[model samples]
Target: MKKKTIIEIFIFLLLLVFGLHSDAQEDHSKMNMGQASNKDEPRVTVDVPQDQQSKIGLKTTKAKKEKTLHTIRTVGTVTADQTKEAHVHTKINGWIEEIYADYVGKAVKKGQPLFDLYSPDLVSTQEEYISAKEQKSAGSDIAKVALERLKLWGVSQKETDRLVKTRKAKRSLSFDSPVDGFIVNKTAIRGMYINPEMELYHIADLSRIWIVVTLYESDIATISVGDDAELRLPYDLNKTFKGKISYIYPEIETETRTAKARIEIENKDQKLKPGMFVNVEVKKDLGEAVVIPDDSVIDTGTRRIVFVKTSQSRFEPREIKVGPRVGNSFIVLSGLKDQEEVVSSAHFLIDAESKLQAALRKGESQPAGHQGHGK
Candidate 1:
């Protein structure tokens, strides 16, 4: 009889433990449902007091659909245009006898003597031509061939004509500049041996120069060849150089994900020097888009919020995606519609007021026992 009594007490304790656990689980489920319901409910709207509106200078403006010119600003470096550059090289193995345009930055006109080269092969070829000229009965074909050989070695027509008329092979052959430009480079020494593989001088015309601008991938699509651009020097803000896009590099820089654009500007005064930094502005007309004042949008770094005027007094915070900024306005990409009015001024005060109101309302609506449930 004592054993049966003990068993009955043991079964009663087990039932009591399970019943307490069931009650705790039921309460927990109700708390979760309440928290989820609160999350889905829309935030309460805040009404800006009419008396305080004028004190804070609250202002509103309607979003309008209009064409906006978006300007892309970047920095670029000045460079010499490759089309106006010339590389002087020797065609034969020889020694440099003399250099007329010997200094860098020296100006040279077209057909101006640049250097003189002494080559044994050139002297031997000249002798062959002169010998063929003296013996005309030996067939003019030999002389014609030798003259062509001289021309191939960069012997000018004037030099060859003089050689044939004088009947003498000059010790050295003189070379002249092919174009009018400044000598940008000079590497040939008076007695240094030169070969076809060596470059003697580099000449470039500075009347026209190129500006290479680096642009991010996102900005590349807005620019194209023939587009007009404006350049300004940082220290000298009074003057502006205008130019057009001559080319866009097809390859992108792997590390920076940026591309290069070439702009040709006339440098009549020779003020723009190579390697100098200049600011560039590329303006493009984007078709009509929904736009609002720049002050209307509040950027929280993570998300962009704008206080939209729902009614005369009611203001609601809305999230929006914004495109490029033009002048003092921003192009709205989404979450805002045309003809809608937004709080352009004093919106930050309204944002603060709205958050406070929401916090207060949430505390009152939540159940008493669920203090830390939602959090």
Candidate 2:
């Protein structure tokens, strides 16, 4: 009976210990569940006193729908306008006797004498015209044919009349410039034999010029003819010339993987010279978009953050998706709305406080997957 009593007491003691262990485990599991539930609910609010705000120059601006211009900047080169370019070629084979516009870079005006050429064929045609006139058969078909031949050869009617009045064919005929421009190229020389195949002079009017810029395949779609652009010379930054996109080449350059865009600008002052490098800005109107001051947003490489004012002295950090930036603002694509206010100046000070508060909250929160053990 004594051994039975001892065994029964021992079994009761074991049951008591096991019951306490299970109760401790249940309590520990409940505590862990409570902590885990709170881990994901980290706090993210910051309060700045009035004095602190004033000290940091913290300022806010209300976001609103505003018309903005998206600019694409690129480098380009100035070139002569091809349509205004003139290539001087001889209509008949001749020998250059005199060169008035003798050298490259010389400015020439319309109807200005460029050079004098002597061609036997031209002299012969003039003599025939004079003979037709002397016969008083100038109105006859033969005389008309002679006059037409001289005209077809680029002989002016004045020169033909001079031949008729003098009854003598001049050895050389003077040729005048057809346009007012600078002589970009000149191949005609005194006493040099010339033919129609030779281009004697290349004149280009510099009053209007073209700036050809290269655009990547991605940027080409946003550009079109008649889009406004601004051009600035590398040497001159203060002055900007207004221009328009006049043409876009259909073919893409294979080596550079870019397409060419032509911008026409008036340079009546002749300040812009061909072959000079220039900076081009093509502004595209994005219409109405949600915009905030440029200084309002903080760009962390991984994401963009902006401190948004929730109430007086209270701010919240918001991650936003942003589009192209305009002059002094950014196009907010998401995470913001019109009429909302955001910190615009000295927001770095507010940002630091907000991030610190968030970090502390995260540290205070218990780990989600942690399991507590019972003593």
* Highest lDDT scorer: 1
Assess every candidate by TM-score.
0.76, 0.63
Q: What TM-score number comes out for model 1?
A: 0.76
lDDT of 1 by residue, 1-375 (tens): 578546545543433333311122222222211222332322234565556567667888999999889888999999888888899987889998988998999999878888888999999998988898888878478888988988888876778889878989999988888787888888988999999889898999889999999999988877789989999999998899999999999999999999999999999899998889999998888889999999999886656778777766667677789988888999999989999999998775565554444444557668887867766
Q: After superposition, how far is residue 13 of candidate 2 from its true place, in Å?
A: 45
C-alpha lDDT values of all predictions: 0.79, 0.77
Model 1 residue 297 lDDT score: 92
**Per-residue lDDT over 111-228 for candidate 2, one digit per residue giving the tens place of the 0 to 100 score:** 8889888999988877776777677854456667877887777666567677656878888888888889999999889999999999999999999999999888777876789999
| Error of model 2, residue 64, in angstroms | 5.8
